[model samples]
Target: MGAAEATDVESEYSSLVDFEGPDDPSHPFNWSLPRRVWTTAVVAVLNLIGTAASSIFETGNGQFMKEFGISHEVAVLGTSLFLAGYILGFLTFGPLSERFGRKWPLLCGLAVSSLFDLMPALGHSLPAILIGRFFGGLFGVAPVAVFGGVLSDCWPTAQRGIAMALTVSLVFSGPTWGPVFGGFIMGSSALDWRWNMWVVIIAGLSATALCVVVFPETYPPAILRRKARRLRKKTGDESIRTASDKEGLSLQEITRVYLIRPFWLFTTQPILALLTLYQSFVYGVLFLFYQTYPVAFGTNRGWATSLEYLPLLAIIVGIFVAAIGIVIHNQLYFRHHCHTPDGVFIPESRLPPMIVGGILVPIGMFWFAWTATPAVAWASPICASVVIGAGMYLLFIQGFNYIVDCYTTMANSAMGVNGSMRSIFGTVFPLFATQMVHALGVARTTTILGALSAALVPVPICFWYWGDRIRAWSSAKVATF
Candidate 1:
């Protein structure tokens, strides 16, 4: 080759490796479509496995109570501890991901969580199982915090609605299917509760393996840092540097961004604060149903065996079917009206499905509570669960998408804060589920939750109307609509 041609080629290569600005092609936003989709799928699978493991043990709570000679409240701790661990995990892992990068932390967490999943299978004691479950959740937070960040890194704001909808749908669907499968496994005389843990452990292992294989490094700063390191190594010159090294926060500064900033946003932003509360309450109610279903179907309604309660699968199917309409709407809005650089139309468009979901939630709860009697037939309550599940997904989809639209650059941090609060609710709600039903009766207990649901309907209305003003008032960083 001629010297001039070689010089020109060198200039092009140098420009590609510069990585000095927002326009860098190495950024995750510029990754090829196949790579982006594969990364998203891996993250989604990790979330699904983590969530599935959280509630799978609940299906065998009866056997756990029998074997451990513990009260219902104590046996419930197996589920509660998992959520508590997740709460704590979110606080720690979210910031940690910002520091060390997404891949290592997620891989380490999945490894630790998988190990914890196996521990309960080996230990016979209740306390051991509880401890193991708690640690499992703690490690499992990696997927929850990192997945949204991964999505934000790859997908544009307009396209993210459908991607996030799929992710949340998988997360919600995981716990529902876990018990269905767990019931079948535990119902077999040949296997016991240990099989539940084993099944989850196997699934976790499979997901972890898939993640390690298919998931590439998506975080842009981390990629550039690695490139800088390689350049320094090859040239033996100390001047090589990444864009992040020049402009990014120090470890202490990043810590403040990850830890303190979320609290600031939580306290100062009315929209974030209110949405957090509404989402937490809905999440709590959903977790309550996890415990309530076993009691309502198995004990109160005279289901003779483990298999008899399997009709709860209908609720899951119904939820998926109803969620499809919301997904379709999200896709349609994005295709037509949601095209905006500043992300205004997306948030406004989320309100319609959210309003419909809010109405369905309370109506379904009332229906289930009133018709739970054996004489009414089990289908009555199952149908109610369908409505509740559908409503829950609707609220979940809107809340999540709204947050993503509002906080474009800091979406992961916003999700981390919201996730911590939701986990706290998940941890607390199941403990009182049985007592609430017994003291107030299912009809009254659920009516109270339904009333709460009804009250929250106005939340979306307020957001739909005054959302622009609220964002304008916020001190925390958010997109201007």
Candidate 2:
């Protein structure tokens, strides 16, 4: 039927179930503040554990090499394959959350990923450990992939900045702290490298339990669907149906809409495509540090092996500091120009922090490149890492905020493209990091990364000036909340 015919039929259905009004307490947007905050915190913790698992294996490389009689390059696959698995997870789970709901996909993924963690924890062979890490990343990605949807569900654009900052901070901090935790775990005289995987299993299962007990269904359509069912049963009216009940796509339609749409958005939307590329590059640089940090602090300075991962903590501190900056920006700018007199939200308001972040990324890289020498005090490079950390955090959180604001309802698909692209970079960057440092030297390798980031600084700056026009140029029929 045509649109008019469908509307006429929907109006004829007196038993249709929906939220009573905009302020209905059953709607996720109308949920109490404490409940929303608690849900966001739970999702963030889950994201931390999933992303942390991506890098934690690096600290166990020595054990892997010794146990398997493999070279360092070969052992790096444990990290690389885990990241490769993230691409699969993003592609699978991000859209699934849109179809199913956030809660079950997240809980199920966490539980299964925890089960896979046992493969690495208990397996004796290298293949078993590597395969387990890959599957663990695959199943563990629901929290990372579906998080933006939860934020969009529970908070309005006006109040989402600080939540995004705090959550994304944990997202990045997970990887930054992973190796640190793994370092200590591996350092234990009694614990083997397998203990690292065991930690992931413990954390994953605990997070799942918390979500099962605390999290409610936050997706609007999913909630409406359930409400429709409840109303149908209570009133003995089989005609009770939600608007989502009308959206029964066929198998081919489902494939095109959910599976193909993200890749299409990534390729067609110039703004999304370019920003995703920039985000991917920044993410790649982060993984590069996993390889280069040891060289800068340990190999060159003669620091003990276990102590080398400490510099990563500087990055974590910068992440929280950037979170504070985002909160301030929301208070100062969002309150002023969030909407025009006509009440159209200004998505460009999110760009200023990202612009500052773009500038700081290259600056920090250059600073670290020059100061990361045994001749200089160790504090200098560590401080540079702080700058890099702050810069990366702002870039990541604001980019997400911008997409969530701009795309609104389609944010999950946009994020799926984003997560997959960055995971690709995250997977590939490290495999060459050690080689790049060996060939170019630490200063030169870092200088090259700095120059690359410098070239992309125009992205946010240009978007700040012309994002409205760029968004207008898009033909996609994206629905705004």
Writing each residue's lDDT as its tens digit, candidate 1 over 76-195 gives 898889999988798778777776788888878977898998778888776788899999999977787777777777887657767777777777777777777887887788998889
Cα lDDT for residue 182, model 2?
A: 86
lDDT tens readout by residue for model 2, 1-481? 8999988887756566778899999888898999999999989988888888889888888888898899888889989988898998998998788788889998999899899889888888778888998998899887888887898799986687778878889987888888889877876789888888889889989878877987898999999889888888898888788776776689998777778888888877888889999999999999999889888987899877678888999999989999998888888877697788998888888898899999999999999999999999999999999999999998998898787677766777788889999999999998889889989889999999999999999999999999898888763444321
* Structure candidate 1, residue pairs in collision: none
Q: Which pairs clash inside model 2?
A: none
Per-prediction TM-score: 0.88, 0.93
Return the top candidate by TM-score.
2
